[model samples]
Target: MEPPPPPPRWFQRLDRRLRLSPLGVAWTSGREMELMHRAMGFAALGFLTLVPVLVLVAAAQPSSGHGFARWLGQAIGVTHESQLQVERLFGVPNTALQRTTAFGLAALAVFGLTFGSAVQTGYEKVWDLPTARWHTMWRHVVFLALLVGALLGFVNTPAPSGDVTGPLTVVVLDLIGTFLFFWIAQHILLGGRVRWIALLPGAVATTLGLLGLRGFSQLVFSPLIASSAVTYGPFGTVLVVQSWLVGVGFVVYGGALVGRLAHEGRVFRRLKDQDET
Candidate 1:
């Protein structure tokens, strides 16, 4: 019986030039979510807090093939040359275990828990949920454990061959695994307040974004790694890796944002939701 109200004047003018009603909502949402800032936070916390724990877990596993470096390589899909650079950047597993002390191990675990909390906070923000109670710390512990197990399992996923089935199988398995991970992650991290169906779009979007990032890494960061290593040495390598991590952060939150937009039917309103802020 009624037409949709006209979009705000700002959107009306901008839409005329660029027809950006679709993308405009995303840009505005990114600002509202502090998306980039949260992503950078993810990169920093992931590297500083969680990585050491992962390095140890990867190295400690009796079956660890290439250790953490191998997992990192697969996670980001680096080129062969870039993979070598990453291997050199991190210490070997045995040496790490040898150098580690009980107190140090405890510290790493604590730091890992903190990293989980940071991610939980981000998820809460996405759903406009308030922070969970302190007693929920156990959820962080569980999430950290699952994350490590999942990553370790990922590195062990068999390499694909030249045959059609091999690649297809690998792709199918990856999609399933990654999807399950994010899907479960949201449920656990958000304390299960958000329904599984509500979280599905974010999980699927994140998985696709990761697949795209892997291809982009092969084309872009793979070369940048070689050059950065030559120009900036190990520090250069760190820079490239950090930049990649930022991309990961963007995708993680971006996917959830997209899911939220779809659920709320805010995909086309542009600035109309300004009051909702």
Candidate 2:
């Protein structure tokens, strides 16, 4: 019989390094980096499509006009200058705004379908599962509803006034809310196949990573936004938003990989038990 083909050089190196650390074992065993690479394209596409829809929705709410802008600025680590540029670009007469909203909403509905489908495809790939058929419309609707609700909650929360504790409090609440949102997304997108216990690690990791990204953005991307604004005008905000979404896509894929690894480990244990019996 022919000898088994030798392992890839990269895998061999990975294995050698992975053996030195338990966490590395879990991470490499799931091949999360590989999965992240595959899922990122779809995730980025979903974000690109979804962002315009969010802008439209925020524009439609006149009473909370500045609220959305402020939230967007905070989310992307941009300054008020960037937010002002956004408002100026989108500003128009009421009649024009109404027409724009109508057209934008229609376009968003179509794009939302694409976004949902892309997210489902990513989940299916990570879990090594067949495509899900049931509750397609329901799932998409629920997903959008959850997202809108989360945004509203974040924007409506009162901003910190004076106390040092206030900012920290907001951050903690935001982290918890983000964790819950990610957890629900995993459960819903995976068709409820993954258990809650197995999903927690990935959800937490993703949430913390996202929170870290938010902090990192201020130090890194803020200057980029400022320069782009000077050179490119209002469209600079769009560039920053796109870059932020790409980071989000990578985080989403990483979280899914973590959850998948935990689920597979559990399955392997059960099979080993059965074989021993």
Candidate 3:
């Protein structure tokens, strides 16, 4: 009997489906996970840098919430009376949740942009490719950074009158921006020529991840909220540092997973074809 040809490299291991064509699959299957890791890492890193800047911003205007307040008044065309009412409800950096949320939100975007670049590089590695030049990869990141920054601004901003309009606007804008960012990032990292329709999977995955993480955080960290406030003390600092490390690790693994799945799906169908032949 004639010997069968050796299996293709993309199908070298029939059982190891996860290791097949990891680069190709990662562009689709694992992109959202990579983005999640990037976002979390950036937010954590941002917190490290932003706390100090916020302290400085706070010190500069200790007497009033003027910096943020003015930003609000101008952004949404609200009257001073409406702004003051919000200020009273949310208070200033001295002791307001808004202050923490503001710094947190800003850090999230800044650091997310930083870490996202690294995640894309990891994606490139799984594709057995050299890292893309900054020129090639940067415009996408810059666009995402601006888009996310604007969303964060809206999320952190206090409502003009505690009405639904402002918060609703922020939510709608954030969701739309997030979906667009996903589409663009995938295009850049995967070098895929795709339309926005191709991004539906990414959008759905991201929304699911966000919701899942929200629930996980609420369940896992809820106890800490009441027991002791977590801060940047040594222990909390270690935890934050570890989370970023873990996030980076996940990005790499996610890239590989994506590549493998894409490779496998293709190879499996090819193998079935050969058997039929």
Best by TM-score: 1
lDDT of 2 by residue, 1-277 (tens): 9999999999999888877565785466446436556456655665555545555566566666556556766776766666666456544233434566566767777677666666766777666678878556578667766777787788767777799999889888989999999889878777788778777877887897787788888777767777887899878756766677767776777676666666677788999999999
Best to worst by TM-score, what's the order? 1, 2, 3
**Leading candidate by lDDT:** 1
**Model 1 worst lDDT window (10 residues):** 263-272
How well does each candidate superpose onto the true structure, as a TM-score? 0.85, 0.77, 0.46
Stretches off by above 4 angstroms in model 2 are: 1-15, 18-49, 79-97, 101-103, 262-277
List, residue by residue over 1-277, the lDDT tens digit for candidate 1. 8999989999878776563464777787788879999999889888886678777766776577466777677667788888899989975557777889999988877778888998898888888899999999999988998887887677677778989999789788888998899999989999989988889889988899888998888888888988999999999989988989989888888888787767666434545677577
lDDT of candidate model 1 versus the reference: 0.83
**Candidate 3 lDDT score relative to the true structure:** 0.48
lDDT order of candidates, top first: 1, 2, 3
Better of 2 and 3 by TM-score: 2
Cα RMSDs of all predictions? 7.1, 4.9, 11.2
Clashes of 2: 0
